[model samples]
Target: MSTPVPLPITWSPRRNRLVLLPLSAAMVVLFTVMAFVLPANWHLNDRVAMVVSGLLFAGVGLMLARPRVTADEEGVTVVNFVRTRRLAWAEVVRVNLRAGDPWVILDLADGTALAAVGIQPAGGRVQAIQAARTLRDLVDERAVPQDGSTTAQG
Candidate 1:
């Protein structure tokens, strides 16, 4: 049997942080520098606008980097770019990360499949697989029957 995945774990995209965070910081600095270097003829409003634009870019970048999945004994919490969802163990029916899929997806009892963008293959398929398996193991271990009963029916 496969080993069980430890609980109270959090998963996020490593490659995304490595690539995006630095790029966002660099863009902010570059835009600010560019604003000051603009021709003297440019109005102060133009410089302020440029700096504001840079700040906005950084804000959006921070949001993009926020995707993450947290699992504890009670349930799973998925935080996407701008949305967060909490699902009980039984609410999840399946966990899959098929080839070419951007991220892991959880099939819920509500008949919906939710994308877990926090666990992406960009971090390497092996890592993604590990994360997927971790969640799968948790679901298998904690998920209750759809009918919410532990007893077997004769």
Candidate 2:
């Protein structure tokens, strides 16, 4: 039988929109200042600067509008505005969704853990717990730990 895919239950940034809003606003302010503060005599340079900065700002807005997520036969891929990562199903060792700060913890063979942020459900505690458990089971079933172990037999 074919193995099931490890899909991404949720995909988002560790820092929320509220957290990035301020920084984005600050960039706008800085860009605006640079664009307008320059002397009018330096017309060409100022115009170019303004256009570039505006394009950058627009790009940021677009990224915010569409946070990225890709899940397939292998595993989940989450793209935060700054970085993107593809996690393979076998590499994901565990998913820990705890109270107060629910997260998917990926345990690696090298004793490393990667916390997948932004997969939390909107429901109350019970729902979160259930989701966490489900993720855990999925990862557990697929992953093969080290110690020269093999999960499948011919």
Please report, in order, the local distance difference test score of every candidate based on alpha carbons. Answer: 0.89, 0.61
Q: Report the CA-based lDDT of candidate 1 relative to the real structure.
A: 0.89
lDDT of 1 by residue, 1-154 (tens): 5765667899998778877798889879988999999999999999999988998998888888999999997899999999999999889999999999999999999999999999989888899998898889888878888777874422
Tens digit of lDDT per residue, candidate 2, span 1-154?
A: 4455455455444344555566667777777777777777878777677858866885686466344444555675756546777877676766766656754555655578765544544334565566566566666666766664868733
Model 1: runs farther than 4 Å from truth?
151-154
In candidate 2, clashing pairs total 0
Q: Candidate 2: misplaced stretches above 4 Å?
A: 1-42, 62-69, 118-134, 145-154
